[model samples]
Target: MFNNVYPREKYLKKIRPFYDSDIIKVITGIRRCGKSFILKAIMNELIDRGIPKTQIIYIPLDRRGYKNIKTSEELETKIESMLGDDENYYLFIDEVQNVFGFESVIHAYAEEGYSIFLTGSNSYLLSDEISTKLTGRYLNFETFTLDFSEYLEMKRFFKKKIDQDIYVEFEEYILNGGFPKTIEFDDIQARQTYTRGIISEIFEKDVKTRKRISNVPVYERVQSFLLNNYSAPFSLSNLLECLEKEGYKTKATTVRGYIEDLKKAKIIYECNRFDLKSKKSLRREQKYYLSDLAIYFAMNTDNRLSYGPSLENMVYLYLASQDYQISIGKIGKLECDFITRNTSGDYAYIQVTYTMQGEDIKATERIKEREYRPFRKIRDGYPRYIVSLDRFRDQQEGVHHINAIDLFLGKEKI
Candidate 1:
């Protein structure tokens, strides 16, 4: 139905309500996160809904035909020549940020009631400038590299051999990550190599070309630090101290600026800490999660799985993709892995661990208590959970312990 395009229903379900509406759909993500592929899937949806192929326009600015259209005027002329006075036209443009001053052109079409869709590799498409120009005209839906479920499904789509034991595949999913394109490669070496290529492509086209870094070496160190230590909490001062300890002299401001550049380029996402006592968000000691675990695997030589942080990172991406506003919850000495709020003001607290089963009798109970302690301290009656790889799905102290495999495979929900 998607013309060889694997359907990302998580995305399509959100956009389906506005399929034929006048609202402009904006899809943004890291490089090669299948932004363009989702655009094609949307076009196929339009066709299945009885929209003619002629009335649907697919223009990828980075591709050969439109590569020369670098200015807004050129883009406007091309789009104008393609439109006609027939039924409503469904316009899809990938890599829309390639053309300078392209917002006005997109806004122009949206204003004319054309059903417009756009995808960009970096955050430039949703910058303050673009926001000001297209205010109240577009609804953005961010995409991620694949989540665990999609990773397994995509392998099936390509006819890759499947293992009956999902735990075997789980290891691969965590190490290989969820980049849709990277799944095309069968071996870990090829997949990791392709992922590294994506990292380089993003830096060249989005990061380096858009932002200037005077000290490339220092920035590289900072990048390596963040990539190597995903899901760890650190402050600028802490980072500065670490750099000084390593014999690298750089100011906190320089480190801060480089981190901002990486975040803006969609390579990393920062998660703030929430003080459960004060009911406020804290700026310091925040954790940063990589766009995909494959990013960490591609950049580092550590193949050993660190389930604590890796599972937490996977849950973070899943919650974010499901449109949950997430933050670290701090209650005095105790901490909850994530405090999430849905669009309807519903709240859910989560704790992620490798297992609830301990090495011994005391250790098993200690593991369970360690994970559920923070949830017990919470004053509110919001839904609390402990997500782990434990085979036992039981409840302790009113906290539900769910298997990570079940949580990701849609057999359960947090």
Candidate 2:
């Protein structure tokens, strides 16, 4: 059904390191984030390397053909029947969590020396049961929707170019998001419809059915609240109060459960507040960003309301996908949008704003005091940045002010 192939080299680079290893490769992400396509790409790579098709066992439990394999035993029996004696095999299972007792089957296959690769749509795929069964035997690769570079690749695939000005494309990207399937549609309505359908499938299969939540309307209200207030700090009590104001009488614990369910399904990401001065994690008033900005656009139907938060969410997702450990920064009364720690123990303090170019001195000073001063308060030597839409350069006092588009396009390094 796809017209062009979008080379997801970032994920492929991650998978290449462990190719043919005994450890199980587990790929987890939100629904329709191209997990199945990644598997197909990997299988094609294996075939190109002279691996026989007969030796590679691929099963997609979500498909109708595999609907009969409801139990772990049935899955194992079918897989085992395809294997031959005394030979290496590659097993690719998509949405493997559909079968109960799947961990046992994975363990059995691992014991037989088969190189196993699997994908699932929820975090529950790596819950305690699976972890305990496959302890020290698996590696997880968390996938996300397309990054800006990948989105650009998709645009190029359709023979569209934005060489002179990219703000036009970036604006559309900020609205439609980077879901692989949604990138093909030139029509705004079609893109929104596609993303709405993805949210519905996630709600139905991943949240409602998986969590056994019968009150879907209540659950949806909680989702709407989160999407509307994306990048804002709110607690369980705050969510409870909002729901109460909406005439939905739900307890704080129920709201917390719903939030957790959305997080597990990868529909939204939660960022905790970290006290920069005290070097501790704050418990209350956490921020949540949606898995894709298109979700908020699909639900709200107005991009203007979510414009600023959408930019912040985009920065958060980009940093996260690059393997940064991110948290909201709070230094006493002041707040910084993101505090990211890289793998090498390097830290970066980032503040994202829509624009910092207005001719109003009061507005610019407000941004500096609120967003820039917090970075100055830190005594530690680390890179600090203020990412916004302004093209002007304001690199002073050890703080770098960069355009958000340049950051997303890899023209500027963090």
Candidate 3:
């Protein structure tokens, strides 16, 4: 029923293979980052693959019809009434967490020999119970907002042709960011209004709904502190102290709970610091990145991206799309933008800078060389890359310097 498709079509290859594999294909992403569209796209693919319309059923739980059906029994009755007994069924459920006892319903469907696909905006919609309940029978595909390349293609809606210089688009993309729905806003006020709406919805659905955090003041304090410190290392104790200074009475456990709710909703993602030399996660402090940069803009008036933190946020979202397990890299005091574990059992060290030229040259080299130290200490030689807004692509020593445009366009690889 949805026609809006952005630049994520490239992931279709990775997505299609897992279809109808007796696994619950769970699509997880931030709200409005196009999880619903991905499900719709999959449904269209199933129809084209000769799966009959009569055999397929799609339910968006956010709709009025299904809003009241929270329990498994109600969901079963609804699905059973809609699904025919004669044919193998393909079920696509959006925002599946709204249904109570969803895991049991999913398990029962799998046992009944039906192929199921589900999408949830909240990260914890499928918990350890769901995983254990459907063990060895589920695969997950993460979705993110439009990348620069995807945003470029999306620009076609405004003009017949795109500008030849992608840097222009890159600048705009960095400023406006990759959320598809927000692009419809033509003015700053409208964009801000829409962005606030998204933030409020996420806070309500992802945090307030699932968490027992009754202290709204403490919750807001924690959220404000985290939002302001985007791309910075934060500890639970540090957060509690800051909240106290700000006149909000809070504790470390409460701050931790608030942060956990954000992670469960997939609103804010944590990348624990990894000691590359030890190849172990360090527990001292963790870095956080929001799923969408525009939301960061909406939350805070001060432009932190001028400090180039937004570039790090962009890299995290893009890497999340590539099926990479991301963590912050630590070598002594130096930190790498991203430490990704590839499928082939190798690791990648990536650094994102707004530009690697001029005054940034010395600092950029230090960042690159610092990344080498920990891997060198461990005798590991997985590829290390420097992604930047540099107009030219160059190779320094063994480190590859790529333009952000090429990185998003899939022209560059690690």
lDDT of prediction 2: 0.85
- Model 1, 155-260: lDDT tens per residue? 8888888789999999988888888987778889999999999988987898788888888888989999899889988778877888899888888888998898
Clashing pairs in 3: 70-100
lDDT of 3 by residue, 254-280 (tens): 677888887887778888888877779
Report the error of model 2 at residue 271, Å: 0.4
Q: How accurate is candidate 1 locally (lDDT)?
A: 0.88
The Cα error of candidate 3 at residue 115, in Å, is 0.9
Q: Number of clashes in model 3?
A: 1
Each candidate: RMSD: 1.3, 2.0, 2.8
TM-score of each: 0.97, 0.95, 0.90
- Give candidate 3's TM-score: 0.90
Off by over 4 Å in 2: 1-4, 158-164
Candidates 1 and 3, the one with greater TM-score: 1
By TM-score, the best candidate is 1
Q: Local distance difference test, per candidate?
A: 0.88, 0.85, 0.76
Lowest lDDT sum, 10 consecutive residues, model 1, at 121-130
